[model samples]
Target: MAILRGNPGEIIKIWHGGIAIHGGLIGGFIAGVIVCKVKNLNPFQIGDIVAPSIILAQGIGRWGNFMNHEAHGGPVSRAFLEQLHLPNFIIENMYINGQYYHPTFLYESIWDVAGFIILVNIRKHLKLGETFFLYLTWYSIGRFFIEGLRTDSLMLTSNIRVAQLVSILLILISISLIVYRRIKYNPPLYSKVGALPWPTKKVK
Candidate 1:
């Protein structure tokens, strides 16, 4: 936007931290609390349902990158894509400078869609909060790789790719949590603990 404003030389520093990222997490947590309170559902079970939807939405949202013509990698050529048997849409729309650039957004969308499908199908068997953690893990893993390929990325003062760094950390944390829970709890989907409660349990 700043560049479009005829100030192409001007550099705008946008604050990326604070309540923005965590707001979604907090909102998800609050929604889980509300669903568990009203429907008598397990918080983890609610997370299982919500986590897939989040990924699906993210995948759908990534198309905005194509429309904006931003977030694409260095540069590429149409002939190269055609020779490699790449999709026509990509070959036609994404090539530049005789080199094929990485479509970071497309890669992320595909990864998110795949992750959503896997998480949704297996959500029922996951322990409470496991699906949420899985969402973070899977999304972060893709983000770390994709961020590295993106031409435009948020950076820290030390010239580090902030998103990639955070994504790597989240991936590690999610993996550790999943492994620890799998080893410690070993929860089953059909267990009495996981099942929806009987109606006779009256509201307080």
Candidate 2:
């Protein structure tokens, strides 16, 4: 981005130029669409199968932020964090630079882990094309609030957190798509599509 903007003054000097998860998601979706189109496949159905793993990856990826000591919240008391009953190692790690901070990265990682578990368990029940949207809804719900706790969030303005804004939009869009699909098709949300045990037949 710094090179594209032709200005290095405002760019944060991070390896790989400060990558954002949302940007990667958008890029992946576009590539998935193109590939699925060429392959004559239903993009949403493929996305459904891939969604749980995506969150699982997110759960594991957050530790990178932990190691880097970024994406943490404001100063907090040891007593306050201790009340949460977190493990000693985590508590000790949170005590960085002589101050304890909320482990926002850990919070997000746990949220993503829970999401992955729930998605995997409920996946067979969701109709084709619905699981992916459910993933978006579930993830955004957590990301919306989690992003609030982060001091390093990307911002569009002084008061506007970019990830929170994207989360809100994704939540709305995913919910709308789910509702529309339910009303229009009335498909069995809890039943498998057919004998194939997968909905690769068509976009229906």
Candidate 3:
């Protein structure tokens, strides 16, 4: 928006004015890594342990977004929402600017919950950090599609949505990390990693 308005400088000025979820996640991940280093704990194991909870938190957080009436999709019709079998109050709250909008928050919340269930179910079987990789892959896949429906997405260009771009990158990174871990790291399984002592003395 700043660039479009002939004031690219406003980009930096407006940056501190709002929070982005992707940035928040990256910040949290970095913090987790640093804490793990300081405590001499296994970061990937910790990530695996928290995977389900993280996704569940994301699912719940969308409710807050819903309450704020932000992050909705483009204009939709009352009948369209009705066809989705949404609850009456929810259908009513979607009405904004004299028109109904798609309940994207609801969509993503459902997606996140589904991911949470999957992660929890498979948590015991995955390799250390694979659950976290799966978390990233799953969330990115869902976000890539859901972001298309959002009316307020950050854009890298008029044609490139920032969230979508990040989602793609994360998806690739997750896959690459999984393969690299298996081929190079040959790390312990999620079920076994927790039994290992702290300062396993290796990042793996």
Candidate 4:
């Protein structure tokens, strides 16, 4: 609406808003729920299984931002990123004010990929539903710090950083859910035969 009101200037302002990403997350969650229902799988279990994959995918997707060169730091010389020996394709394409910017996207992508690998490898040791919580908590923790370094960040009415606020909230929610589930279900710390009251134990 603002863009159509003869205000091209407002377009960049609106584009900088985090509404699209926020909505995308909500939509992704809904889709996950639907997929779980269709598969007759436990929602939390499915979430845990998919969490790492989602992060991995996001890592790959971050390259898109790097290509655009829009999500970068305030200012930096090309030599800085070039010293890192980034791909020539990325170096040639990404620029701001005739200088290379901080590779925020690459940083985030590497972070996400590493986090996903760690989570995936350790997932079996985690309690049910706990993996998802940990994924959320860990990812948000990194994001909170990373968002602080970025030149572009969405803001609330009070000019508070929206991504930072959301990251904190997610971290809190993840911790709360993990604690709540531990208290409520009291599942076994380790898997044992017939540990759960379900299928009968087989006779030797």
Give the alpha-carbon lDDT of every model. Answer: 0.70, 0.84, 0.90, 0.72
- The per-residue C-alpha lDDT of model 4 at residue 6 equals 85
Give the alpha carbon lDDT tens digit for every residue of 1-204 in model 1.
334257643433324323223346656678778867787666655566578898899888788777667678766555655676767886666755445676767788899999999987877666666788889988888888887777777666446787777787888888897787678776545223444553234222
If both were scored by lDDT, which would come out higher, candidate 1 or candidate 2?
A: 2
lDDT of 4 by residue, 1-204 (tens): 434368767644645754445456667789977865665556666566678987888789888787677777656677876898988876766676677667778788889999899998888777766777787787788788877778878766445788888888889998998888788775432222222233222211
Clashes of each: 5, 0, 0, 0
Q: What's the TM-score of every candidate structure? A: 0.69, 0.86, 0.91, 0.76
After superposition, which runs of candidate 1 have C-alpha atoms over 4 Å from their true positions? 1-41, 95-100, 180-204
Best-fitting candidate, measured by TM-score? 3
Q: Which has the higher TM-score value, candidate number 1 or candidate number 4?
A: 4
Checking candidate 1 for backbone clashes, the offending pairs are: 75-99, 76-96, 76-99, 76-100, 77-99
Quick one: ranking by lDDT, best first?
3, 2, 4, 1
Poorest 10 consecutive residues by lDDT, candidate 3 = 8-17
